[model samples]
Target: MLRGQRLGCLSIRKGGSVDTHVEAVLAELAALEDPRMRQVNERHGDDHGVNLTKLRGVAKARGTDHDLALRLWATDDTAARLVAILISRPKSFEASELDSMIREARAVKVHDWLVNYVVKKGPHAEELRVAWLDDPDPVVASAGWALTADVVAKRPELVDLPGLLRTIDAEMKAAPDREQWEMNSTLAAIGIHHPALRPQAIEIGERLEVLKDYPTPPGCTSPFAPIWIGEIVRRQSAG
Candidate 1:
């Protein structure tokens, strides 16, 4: 069953046949934690073939072996492993383990696993992040801030948008300011997701001037801010 042919046997297109194959695949996948296999699965981009429900079952079968899941997942393509991790939601890992995975994975790729699964479900998400935000290490804090901003942009209601702007602003000000390019990149991501924050952000340009000088990267600029702001202002003036 290690070969691709066996995996094909595990594939079912529809109806009861699909259910049976999914069950078999989940069982096999749960038992097999070989990082090499995980890597091969990712290289082959077979994650799309996986049914989420079956992946959840496999994770459930694995029980509390979260570390095992992480190790196996680290070897796979980031996107596929992300889907697997979300399904598994494995618990009972040490704090160090999750933190290590977060740091490691964040650098390799800005995959959604950290935001969706780890931030949403992992036991140490809050604690680790709380510590991270105040970390003396700029690298750690910047990474934490970048991830936090990314997550918050998706669920703006989860945070006080104004407060976040201030927090990020304060951090940027207090830091040595060596990584202007990286900082702008992160800010651009925020702008893409939360148009409402743009006015406040654009205001920062008035004070720093550098913000205005920092032209948005070509082709990556978000229209959300311009569009939403225009509509709101237009309606207000009409009223």
Candidate 2:
């Protein structure tokens, strides 16, 4: 029983076993925290210190529990939300709920996991994608572009490729960092996936020069769109 404990609007029950369950899960997450891990994750703008491998282990133990997921999410703790995303039934959440969640997820890993593991698998993905694309907030808009980039990679027929390139060409250089990263991804995807559009994609990437000099560790691909596009295309052809 969590007694008087309250997480956001959720009232922790006085004597109920459900509160105990949430308490236990949170305790487990707390136990996994490491300062070293937090420092590494902090570099990427994620707030939690729990090792992801251990966090996923916790989720596997809990399995899918939408009710628990909601409770965990209401806690607004980054590690708990990661577990919530893992155990959530993606299609069960309303579009508005997901919209709110994304906006509230300030931590980078929480935002990324919520988008990739929950929202992307939900029925409202395309709806949210459209709604979020033009959002005034650049971070929210970045998620929109992330979804758009996914579509460009896997379902190219559904998007206006030239329009996307035009947007990237005109706006990417001035776009905020988060939004520009995903926009660059979309540009790379267009070049890699569509042979006919490859030339234009490469040209746009070269012209924009976004992330052109990004420092990438050896053995990993660069995020620079022109180089990323070329390397991926070369790999595909070689394969």
Candidate 3:
């Protein structure tokens, strides 16, 4: 558990013989304290959870070492490196690792890649969708949900977009203070693009009351409120 300063390393519970894996890693690191190790570790710091590419080979040589690298990626800054790993070595990360990657990716490009790859012809679309909704960053979650809506609209038979919409709705309801502007914006875009989810999007907009308290971000006007008011006015006049 990560509390204050000391990070608990991964351990195994086998017959009460507990092992502090990180201590063993430190021992190995002490032995390989050469400039060559430093250079390699730095080169591939983003991967293999270390600064050197030499560590990659070394980690690969030992199962325990590989687990240590994964442990580093499990719950911290090294988690960001999982994005790089997914891009380069798609098959490297396990399910938990992908979830960790989603949690750590705060950039738009990271969401873009994850959305695109997960929706492709693969066996992990459901996992990807779950990751999208569960992501800590609202922007990433919104992008993921929007992508799901888009893919569902395009190929309705493959996945259930409506169900995911309900999921989004449920999340919004559950987290009253969750500011999901980016996710809402993405969903609005999806609504504009997909006919099926437009009505649902409008309903969601109504539920959200976007115009009631929409904050105009600095240097930017409100996107949804104006469009929402205009659409309502148009319909009223036509009626």
Candidate 4:
């Protein structure tokens, strides 16, 4: 049977029951898949074929539905999980549950959305951040750095800027791609937000040369930390 036809066969019933809603959403997502979108997303290591804008529309229509979100996440479908993150109540998740979810979220977009939408807003963000920082798995460790970067950007007083720069100097160049990206982000965040440490952050970025030659499209900013830091600081000064 064709994939769409098979998905069409899912029993989507009316009313507010969790199973009914999940099946309905899955059906909606299956219908929204585009081959062109899949090709583009695959280039970025995301497996979903649904356009993110359309997926956000689906989530908007559903509003917040934590029970449905859990059911959708359990489906383990990338699009469904994205919708699940959209509809979830971040505070509703337990620390252990969030940790398990992050570890299981293998799709790049799924992991990204889960961290940005649910994990960051959850109360256990700091707890998970510290636990995952030195995790054996590089991907999990990347998430730890992502959370740490957020803290560095928003709550500088809570983190040790010099220590983070030292870690980035020591570890970023050799770290795996995902972890390295987040560590670089922390480096940029420190330089962008903390003038006192900006010089050291730029020095570390210059010394490492990570993403230095990254091909950035014309209008977008480069991910190289020194350039990223300089551009943002310039913008802040202009504003």
Tell me the deviation in Å of residue 192 in model 2: 0.8
Q: Residues 88-193, candidate 3, lDDT per residue (tens digit)?
A: 3344445554554555544334445554643333455556665565556565466456556556546555565566567656665444222354445444554655
The stretch of ten residues in a row with the least summed lDDT in candidate 2 is 1-10
Q: Could you estimate the TM-score for every candidate? A: 0.43, 0.93, 0.41, 0.91
Tens-digit lDDT track of model 2 for 142-161: 89999999889787777888
If both were scored by lDDT, which would come out higher, candidate 3 or candidate 4? 4
Model 3, poorest ten-residue lDDT window? 1-10
**Each model's lDDT:** 0.48, 0.87, 0.49, 0.87
Could you give me the TM-score of model 1 versus the true structure?
0.43
Query: Per-prediction RMSD in angstroms?
Result: 12.0, 4.9, 11.9, 6.5
Of the two candidates 1 and 2, the one with more favorable lDDT, higher being better, is 2
Model 4: per-residue Cα lDDT over 42-87, one tens digit each: 9988888998999999999999999778778777688998998999
| Predicted structure 1: lDDT | 0.48
Candidate 1: misplaced stretches above 4 Å? 1-68, 73-87, 90-94, 110-112, 150-164, 173-199, 205-220, 223-239
**Superposition error at 142 for model 2 (Å):** 0.5
Question: Which of the two, 1 or 4, has more TM-score?
Answer: 4
Name the lDDT value of residue 66 in candidate 3: 38
Clashes in model 3: which pairs?
A: 40-52, 40-53, 41-51, 41-52, 42-51, 42-52
RMSD of 2: 4.9
Give residue 66's error in model 3 in angstroms: 13
**Arrange candidates by lDDT, highest first: which order?**
4, 2, 3, 1
